[model samples]
Target chain A: MLHEPASQSGPDPASEFKTRLGVWMFLLYCLVYAGFVVINLVSPTTMELTVLWGMNLAVVYGMGLIIFAVILAIVYDFACRRRESALADTPAKGGKQ
Target chain B: MAITAFLIFVAFVLGLSFYLGQRTRTSSGYYAAGGQIHWVVNGVAFAGDYLSAASFLGICGMIAVAGYDGFLYSIGFLAGWIVALFVVAEPMRRLGKYTFTDAVDAKFDSRGIKLAAAISTLIVSIFYLIPQMVGAGVLVEPLLGIPHHWGVIMVGAIVITIVATAGMTSTTWVQFIKGSMLIVFSSILVAAICYRGFTTEPDQGGRVPVHEYATLAATEADSRLTVAEPGWEVVETHEDAAAKAAFAKLARDGRQTWWLISRTDDGVALKETEAVVVAANGTTLINGAPPSAENALRQVGNIEQLRGETDVKSGSISPIELLAGLSDKDTVVKRWKKASFTDADGGKATVYYPTLTRGNVLMRPGLKFKVQGTVLERLDFVSLMLALFLGTAALPHILIRYYTVPSPAAARKSTIVAIIAIGFFYVLTLFMGLGAMINAVINPADSNMAAPLLARSFNSLLFAIISAIAFSTVLGTVAGLIVAASGAVAHDFCDRYLRIPMDDRQKIRAGKLAAFSVGTLAIILGIAFKGMNVSFLVGLAFAVAASANLPAMMMLLFWKRTTAKGIAASIITGVVLSVGLICFSPMMYGQFGLDPTTAPIPFNNPGIVSIPLSFIVLVLVSLSTKNRNSGVAQPA
Candidate 1:
């Protein structure tokens, strides 16, 4: 089977790499997400607003997730592309394969 | 009147369903509509299905009532889409067959994987569907003046028929229509808020305070009313001097009088009975009677001002200003409280306290539990964080959507479109929520009425259109969810597990049947959980998806050491534990004590413990059997 060698491998990805990435990124997201959340815990800005539930804000709540998802997707796409192109030229890398 | 319009819409939806059902000839047509949806159209349909009545109505209502907190939910929800687009879209398309299970099973050929993934998809979709059904029930009742049960049933039959007929094609079109219309009408309502501008003045019919009251009887029971306001909060007035005098004599002689009003049946406004000041020692009387002035505490204050208000345009008020007057106790908010007293027979007599405002925390929890005061605290926050980080990537519907496209490029484009539409919609929700809060014409009784009511403030025609679109929005989403569940059943369980060597046509036909069954089930659940908040239900759905599916999917893709046994074990444990915990939690109970009948679990959500447990189970199982399946895997 056609596969790439290990020259381009990044730090020989550990079992915990994705898990750690998931954790840290999620932490940062929570911090940023708090801005909108704080408003709900406090108050709605409009003097004549429609309704409010605590920590539930309007500005790009779900869309914020979609955007982040898109960004990650782009990154994933690039990484996968690199790996696939590399694998196509070299043989199966010795380690995981 | 509303019924006629709703019925006509229902008929139109049904006719479309029948037309599409007849046209679904191929398995591709039934499952993924032969991978032919335009990115833009699919994106709009995504919006239609995702928005739902809770979003159109309840969220707006919540913001109008609760203020800033309501808008916060909107932000979280929109942000979650980012997780979906960038994380789950394109890669999922490249990997899976007809179902998310296809991706998992392709790697290991494990029956265990198929079973676990199928169950997880089914459970999450079912929980998510309940809220939609409930939303349908809420809307149908008001529009048709029919009870909530019929509303659920109606939505059910229509959705089942739609999915059973045209399959993904009809679902996509329905969603596309619903999504586009919801956004357009919502935009119109936002414009109206701008056109109307902010008015700090009281209503012409005597501005309804955020709270009001009428005495019912000698028993005290208070019912709180939700009011939308831009610059004022109403405090009920109980300044009837004549009635006070009349009741004063009877109250002193231990007699109680009754009054009448809407909603509360136990309200009794106690009058001029001499106030006895009991000292700290329980019964030592300091003053035998109330003060000479009319401004006694027991003598309900009539002249609570439209106080603490400024004339800033309601549209311009920042999130902070929306709830500014909420904390001002002198403004007198309305609520339900019980009055217990002794009777002539030496038995206790009770009355409903109507629109009585004594200071209580506006966002305070009714009872203290681990979860009661802690959603914003560390653990619950962690749970949500985990879900937000992973749920989008793992959602079955999202995974399958990727495969609908021919190439990864189409998936990428669709993801981009979804992001753009979703992002714009989130921005609009901010204005819409704030608009609902300030729209004096909005219904004060239901916070869920915020979006539609905001439209009504512009014009009833706008209101009718917005409401109709919102109903369709539910249909779009329900259709999508049913499609996902049916895929799991038809492709993963029957085709894979049962070893049924069916052709594409039979597979598609079976999927249609499965969609029909699941759709009906969702409708029944929707009716069962009526009146509960839709946002909360959505959160629960996210939690389960994140907890149950994310670990297994991620591990399989990212961890080279992952084993089929591990993936299977993790999915199994995650789904069961989360579902079990949710079912027994205090969120199911009305009280703090351990009540099995009331609680589904010990808390509201199980993400805190269950999520971690899933990861650990996966690791342990993988270690035991990691190398055994090395040669058995298929190429992606």
Candidate 2:
């Protein structure tokens, strides 16, 4: 008997691809979020400048972070579903299906 | 009317729980809602479970008082869901059974992993529970006109019934309903706020005079001024007492009195101020008079002047117009601050003074976070943001929601839904908070009532509905937390770790008992820690979860050299270090009725120090035990 992930009966073909995609996206988000924190620490006065649409950088940047998360999530979900179906249509290489 | 609405809401939630209770007899049904909840429903339920009282009441209240600093919480909180959606959701669903503990121990099958995870779950859940319980009591005071303790007990009883009856099934439905209603009603409230626009004379239709400062020329030490005022006399005077301001007690009708203080200036110019005195006998006097139908604490926050307009109102403006109006240089927003002192008769008195802040300053981040202050203050702000970003993926109640979905795909889809829904709701919080700040609806003594009070300013019916939704918000979050804690007790601690011989029915019974006990404990702590800020408490909870759970969970899933002993050691280290830092932190020292400045730890937040340390400990321990645990199965 071979050990398997607890929630699955057999191995998932797209598991490695999904993990790689997810980790890359996670790192990207971490960098953007860290930028928000660093700006507040290094020079918070920059946040007071009206950067866009007559709103301060603080308001613009904060709202932008929230809206950006939703966009990224939608894209991630779409890409993962495509990869999952693409892998499912191919025949098993070695492990029992 | 508000009471009626609150009662009806409670009845509907209770009835729904009992109806769902009939089908949840099996251990699986009780624990994970039979793992058949729809992706869409579970998605909204995730919103319901995540937007606790801290998000709704605490954020709104903080924004109403402190301006853009409060909006930072909204940003940090929504950022957390991104971590959940991209990193934790699919893997957590694929690796766990009932609780977060199940996932960490799935590869090892070690008792040490089970014990460490279970204790971590219980601690995080309880710490999270305190704020929801406290917010419930705060809502009850104005909504139902009851003491704070009674409200705590009432919410505790209702939530325990919800969790003990049908467990996850009823909890999920409650959260779904709450999530939908919260988003819909909040949208309606935001539309109303945009319609009202900004106004300079917010007290135009009021019966009482506006509580504005009155400046007068100081003549003699004890005698009346040359320009005497009727029904007012100076009874006592103290020179340069508070903040370099000379103080004088002005008596009215020989019984009631207000404060007349003058700041540092070449001339002696005294200004009349509002004061609330709490007598040793427990009676409260507002503005030198006992509160009654005629005399009460006046509603405070308002825009003193709108930009490019003199004494004119901007009626029915657009949402963008509202924000632009708040950021204009010429606009002036009135904010209040309180200073406390012992009066002549040994009674505690707090004087409320107004500062006319520039609109540009109000829309920026210096009011609460104090990022422009010392290095330690900046670190505290950054540490809090770090915790909020990392904490959501590690929360026990949130992690278990993945198990309620059928597959990793469902879990991933549901999390995306949660992010979109929760993100949109957070966007509305900014408008609602700013609306409350400019509408003169804020209660000077308690900022927590800002949102509900802003609704009341609209109409009685909207007020009643919003209050009811707020109460339901408390109910949903508390039920989710209780279920998570009970799962730790029944499944992780008893059945697996202790190797207790228990069937499905017996495990379900044990879970119910745990739910009851935890609920009772929540009630007692809620009443005990009254008057504390709810959002601050939630921040501490997030730090604990980030420290204790995240390091272990991420390592177990991704690191091949991870051992059971290493996971357990990291968890214990994270928990002890985070909890210890918080206990000795300046904020907790203030809560202990001591001088906060004398605390050993300079900062209040602990995430900057604890979270990284936890990861380091895990890596070192796992490397040392690599050879012994070589055969341990890695998670796929």
Candidate 3:
């Protein structure tokens, strides 16, 4: 319950939350892969059959969302790095060295 | 031709194994084949090892009868390899000594991690080995004309011999050979299908009545032979006028087809006694005395042969037609002995199609989860998934595959190859399955008959080749699993636990003996669990991998707060929790004749729950004790 948001360095617990959520993704994959075959043993259909049972909708959407989220996180990380790099490269003119 | 081909194939396989055994003298050679397998050989071996009979025969059988559902296993199995390639292969190669545990505990000096890992490796491997043994037993019964138990024993003995003599060196080359042969023969079978087309009957459906089990054992037999009596039961499926009309149109279109066989049962008393079909029209005479008409029944002869060249030219309509209305009882489809199993009440239940319904009652969940709506049900799914995601990185057999090559790069390359090969194979499963569905040749009585039956529809030569290759693939996979299990027990646990001081050479020697012991045990278990569904057992292996070993590996890689104690706790926790959930779930209980509801868990799968618990435990423990090994725990 105490796990939430994205906490890395600050007084935030979000970082812990992200890791726990990642475990959820892993479980979803397990269920879909294992459960799908057992289901196939019973229902003999095309759409349900051709498209792998657990893999069909969930994996595609889940992966797609994750990719987009990753891209946004990357962009934010990049901008922050750029600002820090510029700050480091700036001339020391008025500081009390 | 059959005996000659069989001898040649056996000679070739055995000879190849001997060559590999010669190279397996060194510890490195025995354990990881001196890390010198060519990627191409390993690549195909990977395919060969990965494509068990469960994949070849099981999936094909599923596809042939169950429509699309059968190919579903192929897809799921292959997709797992994709994860192995992209995410795990190279990273796993960089970690561990003998088992997956070695990798996780690399950062921590913890006995708990060692024990937990050793146990996981043992559990997954033994479970995995059972299926291979079961498949072997099944194949041998038909080929060698032995009992199922005998067949299982033969496989066990053969596998142990191979593993004991050569270690990983022999194991890898065996896998390499088995892998190559399986694919090559499978391709040949596919070609035969394309060239000769399909058959209504192998031996032209002219099995001049072999004394198989079913014909004689109207009474239950004391043995499990590959063959049973043949009699097609009829399944009456509902078809509305509209649907019937559509079917009629489809038939009229010439593309829609039907085939039939005229079967006459010479009711042999459960031995090899003969009774002939008599003319039912009327009794003519008998030795100058009036004979009873009751003794005569009309036997239908093949008229299609005289009716047209088309019937003569027809290649493969028989298998499909035979399966179409096999259970209506009204449709007197001709077949050989249909399989029947006796229940505990001694009620002789013919296992053949009294009904083929895909209802939940038939597909009831295994003992794997909390109740469907309960909190544990949700937790179980979560645990199973966690284990799967993490397990790939932790499987000892999978991990050692990385060491079969020179570097992490090669491991990465091998993974890519595995993904592609596995992916293509999965796709082929769909076609193989769909083809089986329409195929009339596949025996519905035996799900294991799917692939071989499909090949039989084409030609005998192909059937022989595919069956042999399928057998070899079992050998290869079993060998790999045994190697993994043996290494964990010998190198990690024994070397660590007993504190046995051994030179590198001695260590390797001990490992070989361990391999021998495990191989023997596998044979025994395989024979015992022969009746259990292998795919399900494999799923259990996957669950254990995902939960017990995965958490520790992940914590080691990313968590700066990790300590030896945390790693140990998580691994032990993951293994116990995941396994407990699975055993107590409805799936296991139903399988073992225990009350499903009596178990506290709901969903039969535990990966969704146990895997996460592992990671959580590892994280919590690590954070709490991070100060103890802040510098030491950092990745070297």
Candidate 4:
């Protein structure tokens, strides 16, 4: 996001972008989690409804949340790497400082 | 063979500690392992340090009893690491020296920040320590046949030795070894559970008796007690006025068996009742039979009764199949209940009886957190979830791990590793808990022994390995907590607050001394808090950590206007409010021998109230002191 490759005078645009992405990702996950908790409160019996191959909704959803966390972390790491590479390529091409 | 395995494990850890201690001479090496640990190893070590007795024994026990509600803790615990990885991990590594206080006080060199942060760390460390100590006591009773108090003291002494000798260096190595072993052994255990499959009885080939609840007739009664209901004999009775009064009141009220006993001249006869009791330690007496090894632990399991499928009494099943089979409503599951009543023949007898449950109901929530619970009960559940979700990043012991890695980037990478390891282990806990439940391996009296007892169901060898690993689990976690507490005392408080300028040698000395003091205190608290579930104690610890430390931490990292005063005020408020609320909570009132209704706090968990209160205090205090804290908000 910035022309400068390594300068720390202000918040690096790449870092800022990553931070924003991270926060949004976190919020997205939180929404899913909160939805689960709310459902548990509002109509808890829904958690017992079978959604998968004979398994209840709560088990499937709980397992999905755990898997989702791993996927999010992996995505963030990749994005950070891509952003680092983009910054490296940008310094040579020259853009906004 | 079990004793041998446990001995071998203890010897290996102590030997490793002394070897690591030889290399850790400087204050930095002693406190932060010289910031030289590899990120991957440090990450696994994080798992080792974080998965205390509570994670292994307590969660499994809760799952064995409460089913799905227990896994909620695992979810809450793992989710918190997301905050740790993305938020606290990097900044903490960049800012801090040794202790959590170092990180909080990095931007502002105020003495108040140091004192408040240090005290907060001590309070959290002590709170976290109690459960680990209690777990240790619980383990030793079954493993070595030693008294609970002695077991607690043994753990305290061993952990102190580990912390005092090599400090963070040895602690890290122990954690790494412990973490790896725990995962490997747990995986093996899960494989065993899936291989053996589910059975109606704890013993593989035995058949579960289809016993219906029966009524027993009391032939006689005395002044101490009388049988009000025919066929339901009241066997036990207490002559004590308070006991009689309570029983008579309950019986008169016609509520659930209030008067459990009656006093007879010949002896006390117990009210014959049937329940699904998670049996306690010792020989389990079933149907008033003689206490024997076979009936010692209460057994529970789900029977698959699919629409077309004939009843398969016992067979091997995959994890998915196990859950699916359990989800079938027609399947029967057994649960135990313990009822204490005065017996005409036996005074004050608590009997374990099996209660039949539908498989689908066992698979859902509401066993512990009822769906029809009151508003406050629901709020309490949410509050616990919030605490667990927010507590990981703010834990003093967990935060101190950031300083163990070389750089901020390493800290972040290590946190990711910790997350994966921890997350996987939590998933494994579900199968372990279910396995314990189905196999009837639970110690009915103390649910904390469920996992280890589950291992015992298979064979003595596997049981030995799992129990020894569990012992190591306690040691690794307690050692880390002690190290964190020592850093708070010798470094944060003594150096920063009291302004004790010590040479490197003296700094190490002070840290060792501090470790001893904190370890002793942990031992005492552990003994005092016997019989309480370790996971419940850990939940309280999370609430305190999230409330007392997380608000200040998040503000300092993200808020450009955060000041020292705000941080200090938030810490004090969080600690005071949460601890104070816990003291007046219904649970505490029960401990104090008073009616739960008399307690001022309606909620069991203080996180919902305390966390928000902390954030508000931080914001208000920071705005008021904005002028005095010039340039402190800007990161160097």
Candidate 5:
């Protein structure tokens, strides 16, 4: 088979850590999202129940999913930036030079 | 007024494109804005690029008509961005140069991968583009008082110029401007809606009159009735046959008249409602008269009763109060259901009949998604949600935006900004939709005009501004898609896969040519698919993207055993299976003018079946082709 060097840039010292962090967050979100789909599937009437602030589960959950994503994204960004900075400062420790 | 606003908006977008065009001399500059855009600007532009006509017009219209079912789309669409941010954003930025294909083929350098990825990119972009173009047409018809096709052509020509001239630089700035305007304007409209609150008689006190259906009392023995106003002369009424059978016959006969038999306090009553009829000889009538200034189809959508309020208007309220009022049990919203039929005189008629739904029901899921429906129906809802959640990360236009940013961190940060902006915009959609629902401004024949029409209900100036923003929404998204498609054609298909030798100048030229070609193709498809629900088409595009691109991207990034053949095979499988299933699905069957029930696939969405199958195919193919995986990039 013909071989070619990878066209992407050299890997960042924080790449592995970022991937791990991203995957975990993604899976965490997946579970909550799945819960939403399951509730809708099993008993749609549950959505009509007034849950919080006079809004039903449908509005609450739907809006919650959107809001939660924003929160998760902000947290993820802060964590990644902090880790990347840490790795940059001590390249010989827990990361490749 | 709307036309002038629309013209001014278009001119500003074009002028911006020309100003940016001067800097785009090199291939990289044209394709990725020299990879120097500010992360904040890129982020809002990302929202602009992502929020197509489907997100703005389709979702609002869906919410306006189906209540909470429309908000489900907003949730699903926003959730998909989570996938983009957490999974694809940084890696895509780190790997690719310009297009999504560049990122996927970074390790393999295989012609097969290029072919598959480019083809998938083009197909997905075209599918995504059609709805935006159609939405442009839909907007222009009401706003500019022009033919739908003319609007499609104008948008196509303008977007082609925008993309062909400045490429990514122009597209990104256009998106950023549009994204900002959309958020600001939508916020204003939502605030206005909250200020107006709930009103049982929204049309009273000099507002546009709501269309009212005519109801007449009838004895059980009455066999024939004559209606004078709506041109139904000597209408034959039946007592023994079921209502469904009578309606079915009327539907089959092309009759424009819709009659409903209901039990009132004073015996049985026959109701004749709003209809638009077109005779075989080409004459048109709305409510039995020619469609003149005074005889046009009136706007519909109003609250029949407000909970706990005998007063006609609730004056002003908070956003929470608005939601509370809509979900109240005693509040009844008057929504419409449409049907079409041919009459005995060879005239075609479409009618909209009212269904008074409780406020609580209107604020829940059963209106459109039918979560409580049959198993297949529920599956359809599940599949749609799955597609929306997975599709955002996989969409080629969105993926390409990652490359426009400088570093992987910039990609990540910008994506967060996009999520916040997009999420906030979607939340506003709920209020705008509910406001339109009770404001008596929905165009019954076309729900896609709901948001703009709702803006018009407040005043003409808001309407013009909202409509203009909507038109720019289409332009921004179409420019992004065309740029993505053109990149695939020029960089992936022609230069790499076909082994066509070209300099940077030639490559940019080829990309411009591809942009024009794709723009033309989008115009044709947009005009051809006129009147199809914009959101449904976007959902199908999402399904295809999720099925064809997501599995390959996920496996390649994480799974070490993934081979070039596997990626290529999975892409082909994803595209073919999703597109094939869509063709045989019930929705397409109905589009083909066949009985929807006779479709082989009972459900309309293809994501549930196709997405998993693509992943399985990728794994199986990768496992078998492990020996050929020689110099593949290790999982990051």
Candidate 6:
């Protein structure tokens, strides 16, 4: 309901901005994920390095990716909510002026 | 106790299905749960539907056997949800009606869209269904004492009932319940495994060394063996009747010839040992010894200490301590290494043996996806990861799930919740799978039994609970797939393309019949693909989905010039190419009794090629048809 007009006719400014925000964050996450894969492929032996509570590099990195996804989801939800509320608060007369 | 638990679990799911199915009268209700499900509930249901037998049994088994390489599946599958959440979740809810094809054919009234989308949906859904069914059959063998085919039939019958009765309404509730139970039960299993800790030997007793044979050379006529790895060799010629009978039994069982205790001299001698056999009339024999349950499925236990540890045979340790202790380079861990050799009959037989591996080596990547393997093998690994990463958003069953929620916002929130639930469960798989490995709870021959066997190690009660939950997991996923496949048949093909003169009531009826047919097909495929790792089959599913569906979806959403022809052509091309490559890949060649080198495809996964091919076809077709505006998103 917050972006109802965007759903009806065409893409709205707020929705477009949110899309951009999400895609950027997604790309950043992809880079981090790709780093994990590249490391495993090119220099797999490096994963044996002990890191964080004596867990191997691969374990820490794998778990870190999971935790990071959770964090991004929460952050994206709050930011979208804040943006929606901010847009809803803008006056109709001020918008045209 | 296991039967009771399994029956109670089945009864609960059936009751819920009938209750929800009764209210599902409308076509919308039957196909998409009337779009009335709560976002939170739908979110959990997504986890239930997404975490198929592959996620539970297959991933656990892979980790138990292959270590870190197995966990890669868990990571790739979870990460794919991010695509679902951010890219496809909201737009799919806004554009689609019942199936993912609805979203693709939203603007274009082209019959090509309907036909191509329907075929693609059927292919992808059936490919995905095979793994879930195979997993069902695998579970039945150990849990229910029934044959594999019978188990597949039961799952097929149960899932068809769920889909035909209530449709998405029943499917959603089943998934929600099963998903919650899967996570809770896995946590309990992991806790139990950690609390018990590791032991150097099996809990019951130590296995006595009956005979040790260092195989030097083995042929049909004669077998040469040594007492030790570098000891003097002794030739054993099969001239006597008793010795020949023992050699025949060993050959029949596909076991290697080894040293055995000599009957003439009361000492161990180099000879071919006889294999244990179960007669057709129920008699059992193992050389001169009585038949024992040791030949059957058995529990594997972990070691408590390393070669020279102070706290030898410690009773319990924290989960963190268990993994950390196992990571020590000096710790000797039992890892199974599989190899195929030419038997006496000149036939190749793949056999697995327990190899003493260093703990650090066992925990790394080279075990399954070999770093120094053939170039094609490395590419196959990367290609699989790519498919799993990109496939989640494009799957017909997963995409159709967005329509079950009420609004676009609801769909987005639901996807986030699903990511959380799925991500958490995947993390648990790491501990549960590693526990199975350290405890030696996995069968060297069949990796699919790892988790269930691991639970059996603690007690039969936990085993029953875990098996019942895994069965439900298969049920939930299969029901979702059948529902999606049926929608493609009845709605996309039957209604749109065939132009069947039918009311809403008739449409729902057609869907139920289609559901039955798809379920039957799934049962047959499940039986045929038996003995394969569920996760491996799922990887193939992901490849097809990513190749056939993802490109069309991405172009439709982001590109303004994508035409109806583009979407249809891309989907058809993607499906044909991926399936063709898989059929000719080395993996399939091995199954078909053909030389693997004769296969045209270099790697098993076709996503790396098919996905890009789909994208290029869509781009070229859309550009060629640029001037003939179809009135759907034509350059702003």
* Prediction 1 global C-alpha lDDT: 0.59
User: How many angstroms is residue B554 displaced in model 5 relative to the true structure, after the best TM-score fit?
Assistant: 0.4
lDDT (Cα, tens digit) per residue for candidate 4, span B20-132: 88888888898889888899999999999999999999899998877888888888888888888666776667678888888788778878888999999999999999999
Q: What is the DockQ of candidate 1?
A: 0.11
Per-residue CA lDDT of candidate 3, range B1-636, in tens? 333555576666567667767766676777777777777667666776677777777776655554433543554455455445534554556654445765666656567667877888898788778877888887767666789888787766677677777776677777777766666666555544434333322232453221222222221134212113344221111122311210000112222111111122642122211112112444332211234554221111111111112133345333223222221122221222322222232333222211122212111222123224355544554444444444445566877777777655456556555555555555555445444443445443466766765665556776677667767777778878888998888977887655688987798788878987898888778778867876667778778777777677666666667788788788788778877877888778867867677777767778766777888898888778777764346642
The CAPRI category of model 2 is: medium
Instruction: Work out the TM-score per prediction.
Output: 0.71, 0.94, 0.67, 0.87, 0.95, 0.88
Give candidate 5 regions above 4 Å deviation: A1-10, B210-212, B222-234, B237-257, B263-267, B308-311, B631-633
Docking class of 6: acceptable
Task: Give candidate 6 regions above 4 Å deviation.
Answer: A1-13, A91-97, B204-224, B228-294, B297-311, B339-342, B345-350, B634-636
The docking quality of candidate 3, as DockQ, is 0.04
Cα lDDT for residue A55, model 3?
Answer: 31
- Cα lDDT tens digits, model 5, B1-636, are 988998998899899999999879988888888888889999999999999999899989888899999999899999999999889988878778888888888888888889999999999999999999999999888777889999999999999999998999999999999999999999999999888777777873357764566665554445444433343444443332311323211221344445656555766655666778788999998876688888776778888887856456778899988997788778788887776667667778676767789977888788888788999999999999899999999999999888787788888999999999999999999998888888878888888888998888888899999999999999999999999999989978988889789999998999999999999999999999998878878888899999999998998899988888899999999999999999999889877788788999999999999999999998998888888777465674
Better of 1 and 5 by lDDT: 5
Q: Report the TM-score of chain B alone for all candidates.
A: 0.75, 0.95, 0.73, 0.88, 0.95, 0.88
Relative to the true structure, candidate 4 reaches a TM of 0.87
- The CAPRI-style docking tier of model 4 reads acceptable
What is the C-alpha lDDT profile of model 2 across B434-545, one tens digit per residue? 9889888888888888899888888888999999999999999999999999999888898888978999899899999999999999999999989887887898889999
- Model 2 clashing residue pairs (backbone): none
> What value does the lDDT take at residue B440 in candidate 3?
44
